[model samples]
Target: MSKMRPSKKELLEGMTPSTVHANEIANVASGELGLEQNDSLTEEEKMRLVCSRFLDIKEDDLMDGDYFFTELDSGKYDEA
Candidate 1:
């Protein structure tokens, strides 16, 4: 599919805060900027590392809550 481009009108539309947040999520997912890592990784490996780093960052901010995706599970997502 072609990329979704938000127009000036779309950006300046009189949307509620929730709608704006949802739009932001859509923009991020379409050109997402969540996580990244160094070189020497294949495309698949980079994806795994990116997801792992995102989880780690979330855990850092939310230390009071239990992070259920850690390596304690020891499954495919073992690095988290």
Candidate 2:
């Protein structure tokens, strides 16, 4: 018996706002930003660190819910 992976739609539908934000933060922290994983930090803390480093914003602003993340145009989609 083999395990099956979830479909794209299923995966997308299953993600909550926090899950999506965590995934984005992890990717940028590890990949583009080349940040190391800190075991001492919680997911929310890691998110704040990543956003602060990437966007050059203060952690206080993030904690106060003053900033939000958005997907940018990566040229993967055509303008209709």
Top-TM-score structure, candidate number? 2
The lDDT per prediction is 0.60, 0.59
Clashing pairs in 1: none
Best by lDDT: 1
Name the runs in model 1 displaced over 4 angstroms.
Answer: 1-38, 56-80
Candidate 2 residue 14 C-alpha distance from true site, Å: 52
TM-score for each predicted model, relative to the true structure: 0.22, 0.24
lDDT of 1 by residue, 1-80 (tens): 23465897887689777556765556665223333223445779879977887764654465433455554454856555
Error of 2 at 54 (Å): 1.8
Q: Worst ten-residue run, lDDT, model 1?
A: 30-39
Model 2 spans with C-alpha error above 4 angstroms: 1-37, 56-80
Root-mean-square deviation of each candidate, in angstroms?
Answer: 12.9, 17.5
lDDT string for model 2 (41-79, tens) is 778998997878877666666533322222223433446
In Å, residue 29's CA in model 1 sits off its true spot by 32
